[model samples]
Target: MRTIVQQGTRCTALAGYVRPDTLDSALAARAKGLRVAAGCTDLFAAVRGPALSGGILDITAIPELRAISETPEHWRLGATATWSDIRLAPLPPAFDGLKAAARELGAAQVQNAGTLGGNLVNASPAADGAPCLLTLEAEVELASRRGTRRLALGDFLTGPRQTALAEDELLTAVLVPKSAAAGHGAFLKLGARRFLVISIAMAAARLDLDGGRVRHAALAVGACSATARRLPAAEAALAGARADAGLAAAITADLVVPGLSPIDDLRASADYRAAAAVTLLRRAVAGLCTGREAAA
Candidate 1:
């Protein structure tokens, strides 16, 4: 709870918190098993008591970890980049779904302070970022004193509240290949209510057209399984189909329902969640194709 500012950089040091302004310093601290923190929107909510269990390594002061930039082959979202950063970045249409997800995360304050890396680390079953990142085929970059490595977004989220992140590693950034950045994308979420509501079902979709026929499609649904999933069968069914208002017709229950294993929860029943997934996917398809993003 105390900050020391030196040469325009910040380093917070307190009873149980330390924020280092450089990657090397952060990694050295990370090696000691300090909890990694960014934004900490979920951390405070998840902690049952007034204070965190142990020491915290706050990475927000690390300059390199808060940037949003593009390289020739990919767009990099630094792990500390806020939801507002992603929503306002000069990204292509393929990021529309992600931007929409940002807007839907919470009210303005949460959008301003919540970090993308924190979302991945929390690994919530209903995380709004997962489905969108899955559609983009994003990869998370992890760094530790040992070295840095990357994992495909889908592979990183093992299950609800579980991930492939290592104890000694810091999630440095998320990489989106320029190859998947060519098409338009959209997102849809069905919540009990609008503001601050956990999704019962959500879907993210991206589509590329070739000569007025569907050349590529990426469809993913979340809050309907242990982890968000790509609807490959449904995507395959849409291949060569016309890209128009009727694009949603290709979606069928069997194609969309085969892989999900939702359980009955306080928010919604398993059957309702499964059925909502199909509707959300279809609407996401129509939203991306028609340029009128819709929500349910």
Candidate 2:
């Protein structure tokens, strides 16, 4: 049997990992079955699990994959852009909630190296950035030697730790549209510890109001579902309704029915996650209300 630290297949591939400096080269390598390594956080998981697995195709050195740009319609966040980049960016209102979540990602090293694309592809239900981006109705761009295609972020994630990305495709960029850019939003996360811990439950909301009537609302919850999901039912409840404790409670209850589908896990009980998920929704609504009131 292979032993850990054997410097065999898994470690050998990683140890000999080549840094491709161009997008074409990275994409070409990916076309040939090379796995891209952006922070290597998840890569380490596969390597250290006592199995000599697939090799890596290092994408961090590709300059084109790491540029964040602002456009008239939306902000384009590059796939390899670090979490620290998001935290420091003067994002528009809809993404400010995302920036808030970015601050709590992990320790400084992880934040400096962790990329938003990684979070989506890693597909951990507890990923801190997932709920924020999902709530913003973000789109993901995938590129391959063949060409490029775009998919809704929610659709891109198919299940726990799984995504729709093909082996030959690379997650190249994230696009946040203008509507989401100007919307009022908030994100709340619950965990055993404040930082560097996986979330028990999290909620993110983007709301639009006209004359005390909700014109639009987008809410998504994570850590309790197969993947982060937008709460259409809860959002519908908020629509045309005032932002008050009663409306918030109703939305919270609706979330318990559809927004979350928790199961017992080592970090938290399903019952605890179910209750906490609702509480998180309530808190996010309250926070958004407070922010809107302050701005008014």
Model 2 score (lDDT): 0.78
Find the candidate with the highest lDDT and give its number: 1
lDDT (Cα atoms) of all candidates against the true structure: 0.87, 0.78
lDDT of 2 by residue, 38-134 (tens): 7877667766432424456877776656777777777788888888888877666788678878888889998988888888888888888888888
The stretch of ten residues in a row with the least summed lDDT in candidate 1 is: 1-10
In candidate 1, what are the lDDT values of residues 1-296, reduced to their tens digit?
A: 11111112478788778999999999998999888889988887777454565688999998788888888888888899899988988888999999999999998999988999999889998999999999899999999998999999999999889999898999999999999987888999999788688899999999987876789999999999989998889999999998888989789888888877776889899989889998998888887667732321
How does each model score on TM-score?
0.93, 0.90
lDDT for predicted candidate 1 compared with the true structure: 0.87
C-alpha RMSD of each candidate structure in angstroms: 4.8, 7.4
Root-mean-square deviation of candidate 1: 4.8
List pairs with backbone clashes in candidate 2: 35-57
